[model samples]
Target: MGFIETFGIVFILEAADAMIKAADVELVGYENVASGYISVLVRGDVSACMAAVEAGVRAVENMGAKVYSSIVIPSPHPDLLKITQIYNIDNLLP
Candidate 1:
């Protein structure tokens, strides 16, 4: 699993696109935390997730977006998934 949080709609969209294209990851969920903060979640194999996260960060940085944070979890606990509502299902990109 992977997560990328950044500012600006354009940055988020471009970063998500780069992430999805860079690996076999699937979008799981997204959150708009207000005040121009946005978070995206993706799920896939460990390697793919890592690659996607790297791509997301690079894409956002290249676009001059204020990247807040990012993460890649090889095997997240099922309980954590439940709490975050980040299911294995693919979500449409916004």
Candidate 2:
């Protein structure tokens, strides 16, 4: 699991896009915590997740936006998966 948070929808989108293109990963949807703060999530192997997060941060920085936070969890706990499932986009797809 991995995520990158930034201000504004555009910055988040750019981060997500760069993340997906940088590695083999699945988009886990996003979280909007209000006040224009948003986070984009992704899931993949440790190396891939790390690469994705790095790319995301770089992308946002290149756009002149600051990355609020970022993380790459190589082995997430089962409880964390429960929460992440809520943000999973598979349910939204047909």
Candidate 3:
């Protein structure tokens, strides 16, 4: 990759890392997908981690960086384990 591409990847990755740590979210790991984009995995209470993720997004937004798309919260990895054991029939059955 050229300098610009490398910098963009690093910048996004670093931003994601800093955001997670600053929000007190437990980061599982991350991989740089491309310039200004990365996939992040974090572990913690689902809702709590979500809140933290939201905080992280806000921080990025505060920086006035353009997000290519909306930030996403994945189904599992962090709080999926907890959700499975919640014992909520509404969630389980229908």
lDDT of 2 at 9: 98
In terms of lDDT, the best-performing candidate is: 2
Task: For residues 1-94, write the lDDT of model 3, one tens digit per residue.
Answer: 0001112454455445655665555555554556545555444555656665555555555666544433434443444546433433233211
Work out candidate 2's RMSD over C-alphas. Answer: 3.6
- Model 2 bad stretches (over 4 Å): 88-94
| Reference-based TM-score of each model | 0.85, 0.90, 0.49
User: Over the stretch 1-94, how does candidate 2's per-residue lDDT look in tens digits?
Assistant: 8989999999999999999999998887898989999999888888999999999999999999999899987877766655766864543221
lDDT of candidate 1 over 34-74, digit per residue (tens): 99898888888889989999999999988777789999877
Tell me each candidate's RMSD, in Å, in order. 4.2, 3.6, 10.2
**Which candidate number has the best TM-score?**
2
lDDT of each: 0.81, 0.87, 0.45
Better of 1 and 2 by lDDT: 2
User: Which pairs of residues collide in model 3?
Assistant: none
